[model samples]
Target: MNWVVFAIFAYIFLALQKGFGSLISLPEAFGGMAPSLLLIFGVYICLSARAYLALWAMLALGILTDLITTTNPSATIIGPASLGYLLAGFTIIQMRGLVFKESVFTLAILTFSAGVFAGLTTICFFKMRSFSWLTNDPIEGWDSATQMYRYFMMVLYTTVLSFPIGALLYRLSPLFRFHEKKSY
Candidate 1:
């Protein structure tokens, strides 16, 4: 397993996920939604043709996400996100035998469950950086609940959409080539 090759593409994929997630925002403000491609990509990479290379690649991707996603250099959101990615990766890999049989049922369940796991982690990370969690008033608390609920609704909605997208993207064969790693 060539980790360098894996790292290069992993970095690119993370950047794409971050940029595309932000770029394709809906009029209803779907910023809270991640297309689930990232997680599925991570799963694909990890469980792809090369497991070790993909795992190391995913590690690099996580670090890159921490560096680039938020204006905050020390991204508070990336921490929980990193945690979830790590935990999910470990769990997914530990239970890796299922990849031998790629059925629609299995893929659907995996896609949805992994999508939910990744989405919840993102929601928790983003929601933590806010004023809504600090309110003690009952009325304000109720209002915040509605907002959070709405966000979850959107997240789930996007995750559902991510199923076909992730599956379709996974079917594509990646053409590996050299690309410069631009220095910050």
Candidate 2:
């Protein structure tokens, strides 16, 4: 697996997302969020890697993601963010070969599902066990539907952007190998 490419993409996406967040305000519903295409791309690229190793790497990326997301360094937020990203990465592992076929329907379904999960995760982290706990100040002002919509939109944007961006990156660099691993 190309760990180098994985690291590069992760850094760039994280940097850009962080920069954008600082320059402007993310909508209330989608506040404190960033597009994480690199994790997904990492999964796609390392489909053949050992599950244990992959899980650890994704977890680490998630942690790094949390650290970069906020300056306060909240363990509560960091834990869930890592878990959310890890969940998305591992879940997508099952769909490895099918994802590269260039299909919108597949992408929409995947993004929608992942988005909901990710949304619930962070909400749970910041809030109590349920989303109702989020009704306390910044998040308190947001309605449930609005929060859900924001999450959906955020992930949808990432998925839509990732497809072409990943494809382009795959093409631009000869390093990406399409051949499935036939042996361990």
Candidate 3:
């Protein structure tokens, strides 16, 4: 994938995530979860590109996402989001050959699973950070039950949103021309 094009898309998604993400919300019963558009996009790109390219892309995306979205005033620790995204990317890339990548159902499942993995990784990091003596900035409202519930809801919401986004990406794949055709 062209770095320029990827950067453009990254900026756009970041803007949407930062500016308009709150405006869109799930029902109150669902904890008003907003879908992670950036994660969805990252997963889509990871699934579409070669493993090597996807690794770098996911790393860049993850770092940018952490920089943009982190609520910590100190910005002390940076690896949680990046680590989560890398793990998710690696898992998807490893499983890529087993699934039909072009199928919306497959994409949704991949997105959902990846989202859960990323969410769990992030939660674990936060939990560790909260307990560590080195950090003054511990995660507030540290209820494991509530956090896990919210994470599950967010993953589900992200999965629901991924279908359309995946379809759009697949439709525009010809223009980007990132993925290579597989030979028999």
Task: Highest lDDT: give the candidate number.
Answer: 3
Off by over 4 Å in 3: 73-77, 132-137, 179-184
Supply the global lDDT for candidate 2. Answer: 0.57
Tens-place lDDT per residue, model 3, 1-184, is 7667788888888888778767876677886667788888888788788789898888887787677755466554677778888999999999989998888888889888888888888778887766657565566666666767877898898898888888887887766568656468
Q: Mind sharing the TM-score for model 3?
A: 0.87
lDDT comparison, 1 vs 2, better candidate: 2
The candidate with the higher TM-score, 1 or 3, is: 3
Candidate 3's clash total is 0
Best by TM-score: 3
Ten residues in sequence with the least summed lDDT for candidate 3: 68-77
Candidate 1 lDDT (Cα, whole model)?
A: 0.52
TM-score-wise, the better of 1 and 2 is: 2
Tens-digit lDDT track for model 2 on 44-71? 4435355655666667777876777552
| Over 4 Å off, model 2 | 22-34, 39-43, 46-50, 71-76, 97-112, 129-146, 172-184
Work out the TM-score per prediction. 0.57, 0.64, 0.87
Stretch of 10 with least lDDT, candidate 1: 135-144
Which portions of model 1 show Cα errors greater than 4 Å?
27-32, 49-55, 71-78, 99-108, 121-184
Ranking by TM-score: 3, 2, 1
